[model samples]
Target: MALEWVVLSYAAGAEAVMLLLLTLPGLDGLRKGLVAVTKNTLKPLLSVVPFCLFLLMDIYWKYENRPSCGDEHACTPSEYIRHQKSVMKSQRNALLIAATLLLYWLLFSVTHLVIRQQQLSQRLEKLRNED
Candidate 1:
């Protein structure tokens, strides 16, 4: 059981590393091919088969060896509520980070387009003046 948990954790960690690598700018040259491969092969395999396997594993582990609740009668509901609040806060922070990155990328693309258009216009004007 411990070995299975360890292996599953490792697989999840590896998948996370792969995701991070996909996000890096330096890997853009190969990203299209990678995306193709992921879309054609890995995506379906991981999303369907591995996900179901992992879900089953988790359910089995949780059911077979449930964590003991220390003095459940005395357990504070506030603590669970606070934990949920913290999780929500963290999710919000992640969303903010994603939004900021998307905004930066959008601004960069717009600026690049404007610069290219200006250069083209300048070239056209110069040609007209020469003629």
Candidate 2:
């Protein structure tokens, strides 16, 4: 369980770093290489979307099947602690799932835009040279 989240966290962190690198200013020279890397990474990152959905369903299933600690007054200290921990873990996982998906989307969008901008710029330069 812990290992799964650890892996997801690492994936999310990598995507974030790559995203930050892509959006940084004054990197026209580096942008080409970064865009290439991002294009390659986009395929692998597509997997994250489905993975997040699966994890989200797992969280939902666990939530539905989770044992109640009963009403506040009736719950024992141990049961209350357990319930609180479960809720906290669920919330954390859900947030992580959302973040991973969002980063993937942003990465795809930004990479595509960069590629398109490069193509348009090249076309414009060619036209200027022809003139």
Candidate 3:
């Protein structure tokens, strides 16, 4: 579980950095490279969709089987500790799943927009050439 969290954290950080880089000025080369790669091989990235669905299922299972801290005020010290840990773990898992989905959506939308823009540009160039 720790390893999974570490991997996810690194991936999320890398994605955030890439997004920031894409918006910076004087990075047209980097942007074009990303667009080109994405255009050529976007189908592979869609695999993440199923993976995210799995994560969502895991979250649902955890929620359905959550440990109840019956009578919060009356919980013994150990019972309270256990409940707190369980709640924290569940929250972390839910947040990670949400973040992963959001990242996938952002990447997919950006790739689609980039491809559309390229197509429109090509059409405009062809029209200009015919004139």
User: Pick by lDDT: which candidate is best?
Assistant: 2
Clashes of each: 0, 0, 0
Per-candidate RMSD, Å: 11.6, 1.5, 2.9
Q: Which pairs clash inside model 3?
A: none
Candidate 1's residue-wise lDDT over 15-128, tens digit each? 444455555668756765654543353433344334434645555554456333356534467765765565564455344334433433443344345446557978999999
TM-scores, all candidates, are 0.43, 0.94, 0.74
The reply for model 3, stretches above 4 Å from the true place, is: 23-25, 72-74
Stretches of candidate 2 exceeding 4 Å from the true structure: none
Q: Which tens-of-lDDT digit does each residue in 26-76 have in candidate 3?
A: 877687887776545446655655765776677688778876766654777
Candidate order by decreasing lDDT: 2, 3, 1
Instruction: Compose the digit string of candidate 2's lDDT tens values, residues 1-131.
Output: 78889989999998999999999999988999999999998898788888888899999999999887666447778988998999999999999999998988898898898899999999999999999
TM-score of 1: 0.43
Question: Native-vs-model 2 lDDT?
Answer: 0.91
Q: In model 1, which runs have C-alpha deviations exceeding 4 angstroms?
A: 1-75
TM-score ranking from best to worst? 2, 3, 1
Candidate 1 colliding pairs: none
In angstroms, give how far residue 100 of model 2 lies from its true place.
0.6
Q: Which model scores highest in TM-score?
A: 2
